[model samples]
Target: MTAGTVQALVVCSTASGAVTSAGGPVSCGTDAKGNPLYLSTVQAYVVDPASAGYFDAIATPFDYTQAFGFWSVAFTSVVGLYFACLGIGTVVNFLRRA
Candidate 1:
């Protein structure tokens, strides 16, 4: 995807139950044909706050791909702000009677 474009993708869970994805674009650690790696590995661990050690394990399992969407409306808002500020400033200056 090009810059300024929003892309969405599903990310699996990590050992700490955290998920991560590169965001947008079906590229990243893919095969030669541009296919996803399909690496769905779940991680489980029990942290020992005192000893800072605990039991941890991982299971490689594929999960459903969570569909995400992205849209751009900030540009429109920025343009609107620009014209609004210009108009307001002009009005204020004109009414100042200076």
Candidate 2:
């Protein structure tokens, strides 16, 4: 619609995720309850119900932190709809007689 809007679309669209989340640098896989299990610096992280905790040593084989889903299908669909509306508006304006 405007130069600034176009510039933002070109510059940030590729790099910025539709949605995002943040977590601590030292983190580990989530529990079955969907809660984050932070890993200890001393050892590898594990998912064992008895051992995993806010601050504790991990097993020899690291359970490893898992990335949660962030890609937004809804946001992408809305973006697509916005572009479609822009296209349609431009076409409609071009076809109209003064």
Candidate 3:
């Protein structure tokens, strides 16, 4: 298959779950039960040279698994700061009325 094109591979198997012929084109032979075999697809992406730098700049240095903990900690810190500010405002209002 050409670049950026998806290609399907048809795999044939017997009734006992044994593979017969694999890696054939989309129009593959039937299985032992006279039924069509399963089809697997493969694709390749061709990126333009001009856009490669843009993609690199937007890509994250850390994977999602590592970023999850960092985001959770940041969220908790923001919530804590919000409550602290609220508490301070309440105390200031109480003193101003006294």
Q: 1-98 in candidate 3: lDDT tens per residue?
A: 22233344333333323223464334355766687654444343666566677778888486887789899999999999999999999999999999
Best by lDDT: 3
Give all TM-scores, in the order shown. 0.28, 0.28, 0.37
- In terms of lDDT, model 3 sits at 0.62
- Which predicted model would earn the best TM-score? 3
- Where in model 1 is the C-alpha error above 4 Å? 1-71
lDDT of 1 by residue, 1-98 (tens): 12132334344322222233574333236556665554343433434444332222234343434222112356667889999999999999999977
Alpha-carbon deviation at 72 in model 3, angstroms: 0.5
Task: Assess candidate 3 and give its TM-score to the true structure.
Answer: 0.37
Candidate 2 lDDT, tens digit per residue, 20-60?
A: 33643334456677765553322223344443442354334
Score candidate 2 by lDDT. Answer: 0.47
Q: What are the RMSD figures for all models against the true structure?
A: 19.5, 24.1, 9.1
